[model samples]
Target: MSLRRWGAVLAGAALVAGAAVTPALAADPVAPKVTVAPATGLDPAGTKIVVKGTGFDPAANDGKGFGLRVGPAKADVRDRAGKDFQVSRLIKKGAVGSQIPLDDNGNWEYSVTVKAEYVASGTTYSAKKQPFSVFVFGWDTPVLTWDSTTPLKFTEAGDAATGLAWGLRHSWRNYVTRGGGTVTPSNGATLDTAAPNVEPYPYKWKYESSGEGTVSYTGQVTYTFEAHTIWDFTIADPRITFGGDGAGTLTAKVGYAFYGTKTAPEKVRTPSDVVLADLKLKAPAQAGDNVAVDIESAKLTAAGAAAFADFYKPGEALDTGRLVFPGKSGPAPTSSTVPTSSAPPTTTTSSSAPCVLTPDSVKQGNLLWGFKQSFRRYVGIGSGTSITASDGVEITDIDKIDGTGPPSGAYLWGFDSVQYKSATEFTTQFRGKVTFAYPAHSFELSIGRPKVVVAQGKGKLFADVELKTTSGAPSPPISQPGVELASLDLAAAKTTEGAGALSVAGIKVTLGNAEAFAKFYKVGEVLDEATVSLGASCAHLPGPGASGPGAGPGVSDDLVPDVKYRPDSALASTGADSGMWLLWGLVLVGAGLALVLVVRRRPAPGQRP
Candidate 1:
């Protein structure tokens, strides 16, 4: 549908009698071409939907162009109001904000308001209520040869109401008014004062229950009709209720009078609290007890029809109107949460102090890896990638790692979860997550809880890996639990033993799974090597990384722990080459031992005297 919005209406657009021409029936597929958008989800918000037409009869209807209208579904050429006097619109030049003049080619573009006025049909309520449609026909003579129809869908999806107004039934009210009868709202039923007086349900009433869905109103109206004493009837005190789930009822008091049928006296009866209509709520409000809405699709009940002397049949359409309800308020979810207490935990010393070092003992050290350099470059820290580490994990000394990884950076993840099965076999697991996020591409890779297992003289590195990427891109999202990421070649690895300590350094790292990269890298790729340094006090043994009574030379520590010597803390921070650091620490150790011996030998001053 070509539904383009038109801004300004043609100025001084006038409707005049046109030159006459004999009309001929338009044939099939020979109708005027027209288009409109959104044949559904319509409302009365004054929003205009533009309609454009071509090939309409310019010579028909005395050259005044065909009439444009919106009435019912199918927009039948034979019926203008489409079987019900409910709602329709006739397009007249500058008439009630609907106007568009046709050019000589029988083509024109116009805008029509979404709202439609219900035209009273007869003594009955509307026969057709839903699926309103749009149509085009002759203004005077009906030449329906050229035709196009579009069904409109209306919705009040998110609408709410607190107060309501309804005229009960459109045709009944019109019939009563034509017969000089009266309809009054006396008990709390008020008028809008500004709304059109012909509105069916003009009496406004306040909602009594705002229980979200189930609601009631606080007013009533009376319909009084007495036509020449024929059959005087009064339906009064009408009430409406919504059950929230599209089912409800309407109750009212009724009074009927059968003025003597030529032989019998007048028969008068009053029935109180009669079920007037069985309401079928149309498009009820969404869930929650915040606001009430319209009670739609109301129909006459059997008792109601009987009370009306069968003039109207049971299960017929009744007027359903909106009720403007106020929003309800209450305590929010967060405010009702329980509070937590604050305290500290107590720590107890292990009874097995000065213990022997074992392979099962927990150790402390760090591991380094660069991940992948190309992918890191694609999603740098600020551009598209953000990396975070958490869970008792501290990653520092980022630049120390060598080889392909993050640009100008690699990482060291310090782990305290270290255990050993034997002196030569040990396993160490990391504590935290390093998440690389690429928001622009909707891709993320998180590698966490890395565990390195060394057996005999060989080892492997594994970690929990979660990868998310578009399937349209390099790879699909996946969660690989305990993925073997790299193989550790410990052949050149150096394990140093100290006072109850063990340090394994310089283990080569080779890619074990290219899939861990989300297909960004391939297999057989070399990554940064790693080191493990740990120390713990044991039963009858000094912990690792300890210099016991000047007994040995230094160890490797470009701060990495190396075989033969363990460097002092001060020398470890120098960033010296690993081999050089090991050699220097040994020199310092020898010097320290000489000093200790000299001091011990010179301490016999009392014996010399």
Candidate 2:
């Protein structure tokens, strides 16, 4: 339907080699036809169609009754009047147009008025998509296009007055007032991509493979100025890309202060990702999927004229442009004010896909537990007790049902990494760091990396905590990092596939958070009992991990390879293999294989992960 459809590649609408129209007179050779009924949504005082032509010939053009407008889509209009209408009317033969009476077997119904500028006041659009045809002209016979069938959309307006306007480089806006500096734009993300960009901001997209030859624009623009401190430079966020014929690219985040040599030793240099300006789309204007660009002069590709010192050369004509694109992913601007690596957009994959279990469907795994027993005996009772357990954490008694019966302080944590979400859902990560010192009650606690995320049955128990309290209790010691500690249940469990291993136990653990991870513990209480157990493909799911105490160089879950454990055992070592994304997340937890998970929040620690 006509809500949007572009691909002309370069402005000229006709596209796809003139929609269709052959056999000038083969009788019913698809006889002259045209239909537009409720094309689609069209609101704002628009929508009243009925074009119903069938086998025309009431003297053909000698009849001068055709050319109904709303262009693009199966293209090919062979224009003649209505100044190439972007919305017109001309069913001529009496009032010069609009005289639908016909019935000499030429049959005609023709009502009309599908305008409102063909709708599109705001729905962030312009990655090129203005296609929407409905014609029945015959400039010398050969016309009939109504967009296949019922597909003329447009009824969801409400936010498009401030849609990006950009004036970013006319020599950097005439050198920002002769280099005194000032071009700030914030929160409404990139503040409209800077430079007196003026009332402009309403764009957002998700079609990167979202369809068509590449489309990405999250937007951010900055270009500070200065004189001979060597032009104190500062090129803020900018990473816009458009590739489909007229080609384009711009990457930013440069920093500068330069002066003393030794290869310009640090005075400031640290903003990375150059490759600034190199676009070339002289005159674009699609509207609704966005794209208002006008690269009137842009050049400077050698990584953007090597950040300026040589004064422009890589292709010479640097910037006289204006871009408007479909940027601004919605009234979205609250993630504590969007600082997402300044503007990182380019990810689209999800069409049901996700069921994986691969990595040899997890050979061996381990996560056993015992996080509480009177708080591990009041932090090992004073005397400045110290209970450290590096990377592959350990200080176990292997569940003698801990309750403080005999050194059963419990705390296994190993499974390097696993978040297989779906194929029965998952979230099993564990690296270990237990440390519980007692500098004589100044109080300290640690819980390094631990995730448990089951699915259907139930699960939850994130980690990465480190508290240290003293001064006046009631909430002091906190070093936070994904805390959500405990809430699992995994009811009536069942999973016993073994050539060597794969068991499932009576899962149930409470305590959602008490001063964020057991201070005195009591929020539905009940803590003690957890077990995962894996072997090979699971451990090397990635590599080079465990970087706190004792660090890297590990892989001992009882010499991995074709897992198989019980009554407990696999003592220590779960460090290496942690970045082939556990081998593409176990090839997307294989099982009819699919991806793009659900329960968000897990990419940010260096995010984009």
Candidate 3:
């Protein structure tokens, strides 16, 4: 073979190898496979990020490596938009992107700061923005993330660093400033109510203090809004502090209903002094111990006063008048005296003073009394005529009478308006006109005589008497056939002043037409007898040098009566009735003896003796 032929063959073989190698080299340099450590991060500022790449021309441009851009877009490097989007740096196989200094408000789509670029053979070659893990700087700490694409979730501490980069790009605009406090992002606090019926999303940020100090703090955060009409509701108090920690929680609470498009009011006015939340800070206490301020007891303006007034009427005073607090334990003082029944009179009566029972110095009032009677009468008129009567006597007013003046025999008059039932009228013959005149310890009850003819009929009747007090045991029935009237003698126990008990004793019923009545009531009939207790007292009345009636010494105008009724041994044995029963027994015995004698005289042991 010729030398030229060998060389041509070798050159042909070399051309084939070179052709295959050229296609491999010309094909798009496999975009530098890049990965970013810590794919996502908290916004505003976070930990450092590392970029790693493979299959990149390490010797491109004399070992200058790939040119990396850590920004929003590749065009951002060309047009020098602010430093945030125009970050450019040189990266090697495992180089780190420059510390991207972001503003307090972080960026969302800041591409993985590793773009491969090389200048080869007088031609510049650059790879498009490579698909690398994202490093998102967000405004929140990523504790909870909610957006249209990402389901709301609370990130656990262990998984917070993993693929947490999602729809965190949109700007959370500020809605309102309230509570006279400062929020992070400098007024960037907003309420997102875009989702229908969903709670407004809150932006998490640090709250700082303002001009308002802690003392007059009303840590109430309320949101005033209107869906159809203006309404106000509470959210949370950001000013809550615990153990003097400034890094306290800002709890978000749902307030009023959402504003619908059609239901929204024409003009939704923003409240001037509306507080969205309270800003709390830890402070030292006077006792050298840390204590959180009580939010409930703190004086705070009602955030939604107008809204509250719609439900509850305003300006009405609450009734707290009858409330009483128990007194603390303590010993009774020597000067404090206890009331006793045997206590001596505080006033002494002079010897020269008359022993008369002055009406002015006695307690008196309307009293009611009652007694029962049974007798017979013939009706003079077909039906009895009813009449009312009053004791023809009058006494000075108890308040005007003076104890030192002349004793007034004026009776405390009692009047009865008698209503005659048909049965009662026929039986008593309309003789029920009763009246009472009461002096200190005694009383006179008078029943006017009936204007009817007597007859041998029998019936029961009640004589309605007006007694001083009704506080006593009731009397038993007075059922003597001949008895026409009954009497009760009242005696009051002695007391220096004030009301006391009165004893009703010495009960006696007078018999009318005893001789004719004895035919039916055999000299003795079982008469119902009873003892009644009267709640009466000798109360001192208004007089010269005397405190008002019923008032103890050093007391005045205490005219309340303390009448007490107690019954004992209700009725005395009916002595006259017992004697009547004994006489009947003798008569019955005599008759029985006469019957036995007649039987004995007739026969004895079947033989005539």
Candidate 4:
């Protein structure tokens, strides 16, 4: 009977057999089902609008959720706009809002976006008119009317109002929207899309007058603009290669001019005359060729204005005709040539002349005759050497004597002293007399005479001597004063040795002073067992007793009278050297006895002999 209460319960139950009590079954809400994703668009401000709500009511509203309202379309009624177009709060499914802005007024239609509601416990579920669209944030200007039964026509009556303001400023700067600014157009209307890759004439917005107003043509009055896809149209400065049949055509006539109010009949613009009618361009067959285009541009036609007057006659004249297009002339650029080869006719042989050492053939009076020398100075081993001027040395006063240009030959002589005859080494054999003072000892000698540069050529006689002294006396542990000497190819004579004699085993001495002594010589030192010779002599001695030819009072009648060793009948017909033609006939008889002793001792040019 622990079920004591159970006993009572049974009694009560029996008594209440008439129990009709059964009430607790609620699950009937779910009225959500909302949706919005894009659906249409243009610029609903920030526009994100998601809203999705499927059978909502997860524990009804007590859970505090569901209720996304995105304005307008009667706010999706649920107790007459509860929470008035709420903006977002739906949670049993979805609700993304982006703040639901909306206001661009340039109205291109379609508006309403997601006005969902969900409520729950108290019951309410809505979502109607979720369309979309905002548009109008920039260029959309469209009012352009003019098309009265093909009325506007002006062949050229002074260019009918400048071709109706140049076809309405190039059709509103090429179909409007230059948002980044700049669009100028006037009588001469230009704006061919500023060139570069061109392409911009496909416009729209139709309806011309009959349905009453709206025009932006490129579709009629002869429209035609196929600039061959204009690849950066440059005309000159060397860039003239345009062919693929470049084209053009833009005629215009359009009519109607009323201006609002004739019971609403607006349609304006009736002026006319916009041509560019027949421009052709396809000319490059040579001036840099590259063709292609059998025909297109709707099969072209207008070959009018004499085809643009020979289309710029061979093209090249664009100081601003601003694109007239019509080129076609071709052929006239042929110049290639580059073959060259002709150089095999030289020859050149003539040799001879040149063994000349002249100063009037080695002068005489005061003696000059240089070449004919012999040297040997070393003072040892063979008993202090000996062999000074083995028959050479005579130069006493020969002044400027120069020569060159005789089949590779040169000689320059200037002297003032040379008596020579030294020998000391403690009197190895005793000898005295010695002058040698050229320019007081800074001597110089250069000779290279030996001609016949070709025909059996074999000539070479060289020498370059130098000697300096600050006060003479050198030959001991020599010290700096100078002493160069060379003899390179010294002797090879025989261009038929006319002037003959010269053989010291074909000379080749070389020993240009290496710092003068340097402890007894070492720089290119080559004595080669000493023994040298060079010839050619002359002597008359007796001339410095001055009396005329300005030999006195600071003399210098420009010191004339050398006549550069005269005698050159073309250098004596190329074989020269008959002793230089007997010293050129004794230097023309000593220049005719010194011009007859200066004209019997000048007393002319204002006297004074």
Candidate 5:
């Protein structure tokens, strides 16, 4: 073979060998393994991030001295927005190496590419590049919603128009803000007539009349008003009705809001202070035209106030007052001087309906201690004339109807009203005269400082005994006197004869810290942003050591997780009436009567008697 041919064969073999071994030669240098610590997660935006790992260049100085690159030969490391990566921390590297600081959001591909070359003799070689990837999540704000079911109504007897007008007028004060104005009702606005709307907040409702044919009639009919919010919260259910034909019955439910945050359920505080006022009720048909029905009784109560207050401020207390009804036997004499054996059985017969004891009969073994009486007439005119009396009185031994105890010490004010020495104190007393048609004995009593109690049957009607202070002066209304009882001060100018009425079942008042009322409820605690923000600045301290590329991994970067909490509005309802299962004894009675008739007409089995 020729020498030239031999050389060509050898060269060709060498080229083939080099091609086969290319991958091995280019393979990464098997230097000491440098495992980068995982990248700690990032927050919403504009924040610093750290990357911890072992085997970083130890000699690199701070910020400018050493930094991080996302990936390979990519000349400049830039964020998608074209911003250069910023190095914020640096630490001395050791067995447990330093981290690379970054400022960007999204997937990041990194490689430790050094600009300086490690020179040996006349040759120079750059540090081998290592690549890795990390993910950054975008921040999102949370949203929340709320909702509830509620029933509402209003009741006043005698005149339907009068009751309707009074109800429509007073419903506006359902939700009061810092100002005296209602949050939903707006300034000087009336409820929407078509579909009653308080506005802004989302409340919708309707009203109806209990015609003669209806078996169960709320006295004098009723105008139901419903209120709700866009968040699906029910502000109120106005079933507050008066029983007429015989006994009056009414029911109600209300929904409201509480403090809340972006991610928390709505926290409901106390119900926007509720009240009934300006009850100008016309007299019954029998009363001469233009003769207005005077307030027979006026009452204020706080039985449920504590329950509502606790819902607003968990440990907060509420202010409240009691209800008063005049001519209603004062506290049903617990101790009697009259002998039971010699006393005549008080026959209580009424032309309208049978005298049924209010609050149902109390059960004591097989014996219930309760009695029913009719509003009897005083036959003597001025203690001498025989006049028929229509204003009868029914007395019950239920202590639940008595006046409330002393005002709560925790209230904004400790009293319901102020005593007056003269009508001059308030512009005037008995500004409006109250008259009754049937039991016509009209002698003016000092209407000042009267112990007022409204009857449960009258819609917003209140009754009080005209008691002159020892100084022979008139009493001031809660507003002028600063009593603010019943939270009715706002509507004082709109005062009328009767407001909304409710069935009297003898409310049981349990007084205590408002928190006791929340015992039945399981609600989540809510914190204002101000409270949480303060925690962020809870004295930051310098970590034990520095951190970042070229620095050693140490305890400094171990930060506790941040927390965001809010109150839970989705808690289950635990109020007394929230889950009340009312047993309509009247309805049952009607059903029983029908069954008795059915059986009476039934033919004897096979023998058609």
Candidate 6:
């Protein structure tokens, strides 16, 4: 019944030495003094409860410090009323002196006796006992944080927010490496499971004393693990590839949150709650691999808060969750549905017309071709001159086609050469006419290189004006010369044959007259160098940079639509094809079986059965 009696039996059985050495049956010495201190007094869950005692002999030499024998080291406060608490593990023992602390936990009063044997004049005497009462408070509230530098707190409820209240102990899962420990604080206060209405943690504070009887709660408490903004914002899925000289890296911020604790306290006091900012991701090349990041909790400054918002949504701060860093080419949800004004217009009409269909000639002077100079080359003049009765002499239906038109050196319809000579032939001066004459009206149009209109002479005769290329190049050639009435009536030019609608080439006129001075106009078009301007904040960050021939490495083939053939496979093909093939196979087998049956059933004329 007594621990000293139990210790003597244990020592005798545990040690090979006989009863003469066993420290039992000796007279009781002095009662050992015991003192206990809870590891975390505020919220003791896995917190230590150290029991310090003295009067045990330092050396009758067994073990120095002692472990918990009958009581539980961990308290379970899941059921506070019934007080269902159990001890979890024994603390490691160290050398014990006059004051040795035994680490254990429980609110109940228990006794721990340290034993030591002393031989006095060939006789042995038993040491004294050390007893203590453990008063563990506030072990019901669980702290579900991982190894982080800052403490994870809850969002404090204010006058506008709902007041804090305890609920039924909910079953919650904490993610950690198996055998990685977690501390539960509820059970430490009281293991009274039957008393469901009882407060898990005694509301010893004066603030909650008024609403004592009204608190009705039940159910298992669940706590989900989430990462913080610090770890979440850390870049992942970094992609690097060669540009001209250095490699470009593309990455986007990513994260997740679990719905357990809807709100938590903030360790750092700030003007606003920690939130995530929408991220401006930049990279030179396509990132093939996913970036791994760990988000930790931290306080944000004014600038940091703005930056965080760019990466995360409002109220959804980065919590403890594994995120696959978004790649440059990954599909992401549209952040905002409202389109921006600066957003490129899907269908744009330019103020100044692109290469126009005309019957008149371009007479811009001294054009330069393929020069390493300006951004755009000179396209031909708007020659598709329609003289409306209301808008006489005014070229009708000619306006700028913004963000669209013939790709470099392409004519008005993106087909046929705009240049009179080959791309390699370079000339300095030339006169070409893009003349479109109606039965009653005539328009003379001229275009010079880079993009210059030397003259657009139009009366009942010609559009007499000067034209110049955007780069002030020598005159480009005049193309597509024919009577407007005759060319518009051609059936071959207005036919739509295949999958897509009729293309620009479907409508065409004769490139009748094209003349360029061999020396003045340069041949062999050069890809112009484009200068892109970016905004201040987004300047250093990767803006819409030019990509090489293909998307960067690790580019998935699935994204690029297979335009080669069988494009209507989703609609054209179906289960019917497979079913038809199966039906044919089944019919063939049936025919073969029928033949076999016929052969077996055939009668023999010469022989009797």
Top candidate when judged by lDDT against the true structure: 1
Model 5: CA > 4 A from native: 1-163, 166-182, 185-206, 211-237, 240-250, 260-307, 310-609
Compared with the true structure, what per-residue lDDT tens digits does model 2 show for residues 19-117? 442322233334566666646544323344556766565666676455554544333344442223333343433221012345566666654334334
Backbone clash tally (model 3): 13
Superpose all Cα atoms of candidate 5 onto the true structure and report the RMSD in Å to 1 decimal: 42.6
Stronger candidate by lDDT (1 vs 5): 1
What lDDT tens digits, residue by residue, belong to model 3 across residues 391-419? 32222122121222222211112222222
lDDT string, candidate 4, 210-281, tens digits: 101101122222221123111111110001112223443323433332334444534433334333233343
Clashes in each model (backbone N, CA, C under 3 Å)?
32, 46, 13, 7, 63, 129
Q: Can you give the TM-score per candidate against the true fold?
A: 0.30, 0.21, 0.16, 0.13, 0.17, 0.14
Task: Kindly report the root-mean-square deviation of model 3 from the true structure over all alpha carbons.
Answer: 45.9
True-vs-predicted CA distance for residue 205, candidate 3, Å: 63
TM-score of 3: 0.16
What do the candidate models score in CA lDDT, each in turn?
0.50, 0.45, 0.24, 0.22, 0.20, 0.21
Can you write out model 1's per-residue Cα lDDT over 88-123, one digit (the tens) per residue? 333332121112456666677754334433432233
Task: At residue 492, give the lDDT of candidate 3.
Answer: 28
lDDT of 6 by residue, 478-546 (tens): 342221111111232222111111111121121111132212212222211111111111011110111
Give me the displacement of residue 101 in model 6, in angstroms. 9.3
Stretches of model 3 off by over 4 angstroms after superposition: 1-361, 365-387, 392-498, 501-609
lDDT of residue 9 for candidate 4: 68
Model 5, TM vs. native: 0.17
Candidate 1 vs 3: which has more lDDT: 1
What is model 2's C-alpha RMSD?
30.6
